[model samples]
Target: MKTRKRLRSLGVNMIACLLSLIMLIPIVLILLNSFKTSQAASDMSLALPVGGLHFENYTLVIQKGKLGVTFFNSLLYSSGSVLLCVILSALAAYVLSRNRSRLHRFIYVFIVLGITMPINFVSLMKVMQLTLLQNTRIGIILLYTAIQLPFDVFLIYSFVGKIPRDIDEAAVIDGCTPLRLFYSVVLPLLKPVLVTVMVLTFLNTWNEFVLPLYFLGSSSMWPMTLAVYNFFGMYVTDWNLVSADIVLTVLPVVIVYLLGQKHIVAGMTAGAVKS
Candidate 1:
């Protein structure tokens, strides 16, 4: 029985590893072929470059695509939006979860509705124009914050509910004001959920193309993803440059995920189970 159980576990592990490799093959192919010339890539897409390392593709893409500027814009937009979402969501969730009232429940339901409702681009466009937010980085950032608020709020609320009420009561007894209690007592305890919100928000905003495309009309304001799309269109035949751009665009998120995978998994699982 012990031998059989061990064999079953090993089999499952093997299957999981195989599936992971299968999912990673495309990414690996793109990274490898990014070094190859267009002809080489077309001839043998799967194989790595034959003639040593080719840094030219990276240089060309960076220079011609203006990837540096676009990358900075993406970083600014994603980071700023995620920061705002985490702060606002954490505070909102704390209030809703801690303060039990009909109004709190209504607000929670409204936030959930934000998550359920599909983004209406037509209506959104009109709102953008009315708000004078069209064709601007700030517009994209604000839109991202609004779109992502629901999920972030939900995650934080669930986690906050798991926290004991004694903490809040004790803080209040100690002459801590509401804002001070939140910033000093509650925020620290909600670190896990905050990390989860930050990771999700960053990924969504970084990969978001539709909003940026519509709101950021100036090529100078394009994010990395949109810039990559433009690069592909202009250099349709240049597979090397295209692949390099893809690698560059995706590398940051990949690195972030790798670094924070544990926190993300733990926070999400804890929130889901607690809720």
Candidate 2:
């Protein structure tokens, strides 16, 4: 029995490693080809950089990609969405977790429905136009906030449910204000899940493409993803610069995930077993 279980575990581990490599190969190719010359990178070979590197690809991409401005815009959208989403989600989750009323249950169910529902882009665009928020950063941020709030609330609500009720009672008995109690006591315990939400939210907002293209009409307001289109003309595409742009664009997301990786498993599994 022990030998059988050990063999099964080894097989699973090998398969997982193989899958990881499969996922990572494309990223590795992009990084390698980014350093090659335009002609070399154009071939899109997955081989080593044998033809001496073209370091100018990075500089030219930085200039042509308008990376400075686009980076700021991306940061603004991602950070704004995350801040609003996290705060509102935290507040809503706290309320839902603490109050088991039918109203709270209904709200939670509504959020689940939101999760399952597809975004109505046309209606959202119309609403933005009416509010005079079309083609603006504020509009995009608000859209992101609304879209991300449901998932954030769900993750936090699950984590919050696992917290001991004794902590809430103790805080109340000590005359702690409800707001203060949540911030001081409950919020601290929610760090793992909060980090998870922030990482995932940041990634989604950073790499987002279609929404920004449709909503942000002006070239100056484009995010990194949209801004990369500058490297192409109607006739020719610069693969070298494009690859370099991709590397830079996803670097921050990769770094963030690496940093927060430990918290992800903790956060996801924390709410799995009821306390």
Candidate 3:
């Protein structure tokens, strides 16, 4: 029995390693090719560059890609969406979880259904046009917020259900208002899930290109993803510059995920056991 279990564990570990490599190989290739000369990187091989790294690829990418402006654009959109999504999701989840009424349940179900629903871009564009939000920073930010809200609400709703009601009662007994009860008391307890929501929302907003592509007509308002797309078009044959642009675009997401990785796991699993 012990031998059988050990073999099974080893097999699982091996499969996990294989999967990791499968996902990582492309990223490794891009990183390697980003440092090579344009001619060398053309093959997009895994082999290291023969000469010194072409560090200018990054500088050229930044200048030609308009990364400075697009980086700011991405940061603004992501930060705005993360802020709005976290606060609104947390509040909505708290209210719905605490109420437990049929209407609240219906609302929760309706919101969660969005997780699986396909977006109607036609209707979305019409509404954006009607609201005079097209091609604007706030419009893009709000669009990202709406896109991410459903999953954020669902994640927080589960986590909120796991918190004890006694804390709320005690806060009320202490003469705390509803806002105070939520903000001062319950909010702190939701740190793990909140962090999870923030990280997820930020990553989603940062990586999102479709919304910006459809809505942002102006190149000046484009995000990093759009910038990368434009850069790719201009330098289709210059693989090194393209790889460098891709690397820079992915760098922020990698750093953010690595920093919040532990919290993400903790938050997701915390609600599973029903403490």
Candidate 4:
């Protein structure tokens, strides 16, 4: 029995390591190729760089891609959307979780329906036209907020429900207003889930391509993903620059995930075991 258990453990470890390598291989290739010259990259696609590093590809991509502007645009869209989503979702979730009523159930179902239905691009476009949100940052921000709300509300509601009602009662007894109780007491207890929602929102907004492609036509307004796509179109034969752009686009998300992985896991697991 001991030997069987040991073998199973060893097999699982090996499989996990293999899966990690499989997932990492493309990223590794992109990083290595990003440093090669176009000629060298094409000629020895799989080979590692020789001697000194060739950072000319990075310089060229920076110049050609207008990466700084694209990165800034991404920052604005992602941060703004996330802020709106978190605040609105938290409020809505708190109301639904703490105030039990038939109306709360109806609202919950309505929000959940948003998650189930596919986005109607045609209808959304018409709505955008009426609202004059097309080709505007505010429009994109609003759209992202609406699209992301359902999941955010659900996640936050789950966490909020797990918090003790005694806390709210005590705060009210102490002459705390609803807003004060929520802002000062409830919000702090929701930190874990809020972190998870923020991280998820950031990633989704950052990687979003189609929405921005349709709405943001201005080159100056392009985000990292759009910038990378434009770079590829212009430099179709320049593999080195393409790879470098890919690396630049992917690196930030990777860094964020690594930094927030612990928080993300804790947030997701917060309500799993009732305290």
Going through the candidates in order, what is the number of backbone clashes in each? 0, 0, 0, 0
The lDDT of each candidate is: 0.88, 0.84, 0.91, 0.88
Most TM-score-accurate candidate:
1
Higher lDDT: candidate 2 or 3?
A: 3
* Candidate 1 pairs with clashing backbones: none
* lDDT, candidate 3, 1-275, per-residue tens: 99999999999999999999999999999999999999999988999998899999999889988899999999999999999999999999999988978999999999988989999998999999999998889999998988888888988898888899998998899999999999999999999889899988888889989998899999999999888988899899999999999999999999998999987676556536755
Task: Summing lDDT over every window of 10 consecutive residues in candidate 4, give the lowest-scoring window.
Answer: 266-275
The order of the candidates by lDDT, greatest first, is 3, 1, 4, 2
Better of 2 and 3 by TM-score: 3
Sliding window of 10 residues with minimal summed lDDT for model 2? 229-238
Winner on TM-score between 1 and 4 is 1
Instruction: Kindly report the root-mean-square deviation of model 4 from the true structure over all alpha carbons.
Output: 2.4
Comparing candidate 1 with candidate 3, which one achieves the higher TM-score?
1
Which one wins on lDDT?
3
lDDT of 1 by residue, 205-258 (tens): 999899987777799999999999999999888888899999999999899899
Candidate 2 lDDT over 1-275, as tens digits, reads 99999999999999999999999999989899888877777788897777678788888888877889999999999999989888999999889878999999999879857777898888988988999999999999988888888878888987888899999899999999989999999999988788888887888898887788778899888888777655455214567778888888888888888898876556556546765
Stretches of model 4 off by over 4 angstroms after superposition: 1-13, 266-275
**For candidate 4, lDDT tens digit of each residue in 14-86?**
9999999999888888888899878777753668987667898898898889998999989999999999999
TM-score of each: 0.92, 0.87, 0.91, 0.92
Model 3 / residue 56 / CA error / Å:
0.9
Residue pairs in collision within model 3: none
